[model samples]
Target: MFTKSILTAAALAVALPFAANANDGQAMQAATLNVDASAFTTNELAQIAAERGDTRKAERAARIQAQKTEVPGVTNAGRDMQAAILNLDPANFTTNELAQIDAETSALAKAERIEKILDEKSGATVSTSGVKSLTVEYVHHGRDDA
Candidate 1:
């Protein structure tokens, strides 16, 4: 029993540094993301936001769902967001404040979409074709213009 225990400890000691070094090499490789919000319906935007762990987007998605026609997956995203937000501290925010946050969120989503396009065009390995459609829409509609 004593010899087996010693062998196990010795094997673990030898393996630990190699495992750690292997992880270090993996850490150097970057994974790319491509986002195209224009092609994404409101529900998709909400789903992306929720998957990315943005609680505010989830909450806003629920609100949008309430105001608009139902879409299949959006309700789930909204529910996830609501459940996450339930633990947050309650504070009364003015309508203007809420609007400002919503605007910021929308802008960030747009920026991410743009960034994805630029990154992919710049030779990012992860590619999604929706970015091209979004770029065209942005060019034509000028959705983000002040």
Candidate 2:
């Protein structure tokens, strides 16, 4: 009886740690599930989606979240300036030129500024298809451009 009791105690001692670890994992999973999806970065959302085996859905959710949470101080003037900056080829411009581009307020201004900078840098006149459409739309049947 004493031998059986000792064996049982040993088995319990070994099993307790495994049970505790399992509970810890479950608690962590619960905490993860409770977090706001909008707060997650794109990469983090992608990883979580990959873990859940639903890459497409996660990617779509991430895109939606990104659109909803526009970067601070960024504007959607003329085009998505943030996206344009992200897609811009850094190798094509010097640091000063890039900084100049970043300083521009509107997308149309940025494009025009970039063209001028490139022209000056290369010592060649770069023809820019400038401001294709009217940037401002006046409401209440009135318009003024001073």
Candidate 3:
């Protein structure tokens, strides 16, 4: 499960590349699970995942978690699904999390209309820890990383 940091790290490393390369202008499968991070809700998440053709186990679990938590719990559950498409790196996701992403996020959900971050200028590398910041240069064609 992705709740574990080590597993998530390993999974994401492998999933990111796949996701990044999967877009063939296929209308960019929207992240229906793409929460506002502010308005994300338990029932909404479960319903979205279900509409996206995800398994019942995923929706059930999310529902349960939502009922128990005060914040409706938002984890990187769909990291794998996203990685296999948007990230070009599967290692960026975990085993279970990937499943959740696939189960949740939908096409209409992705229709929230986000401003495009296109072109080389859209790429940025900023890593910060506490008051420390680290910079590294990497190439992102939005399709592949070099």
Among all candidates shown, the one with the greatest lDDT: 2
Tell me which of candidates 1 and 3 scores higher on TM-score. 1
CA shift of 94, model 1, Å = 34
Compared with the true structure, what per-residue lDDT tens digits does model 2 show for residues 54-87? Answer: 5665565555455445442344442344335434
What is the lDDT for 103 in model 3?
A: 52
Q: Please identify which of the two predictions, 2 or 3, would achieve the higher TM-score against the true structure.
A: 2
Query: Any runs in candidate 3 off by more than 4 Å, and if so which?
Result: 1-59, 62-81, 93-125, 128-146
Clashing pairs in 2: none
- What's model 2's overall lDDT? 0.54
Candidate 2: 10-residue stretch with minimal lDDT: 129-138
On the 0 to 100 scale, the lDDT of residue 118 in model 1 is: 40
List per-prediction Cα lDDT, in the order shown.
Answer: 0.42, 0.54, 0.40
Weakest lDDT window of 10 consecutive positions for candidate 1:
87-96
lDDT of 2 at 116: 87
lDDT tens digits, residues 1-146, model 1?
99999999999999999987763322332111133333345444545455544465456555544444433223354333432342211122222222223343444464454455345445856443322233223335666566
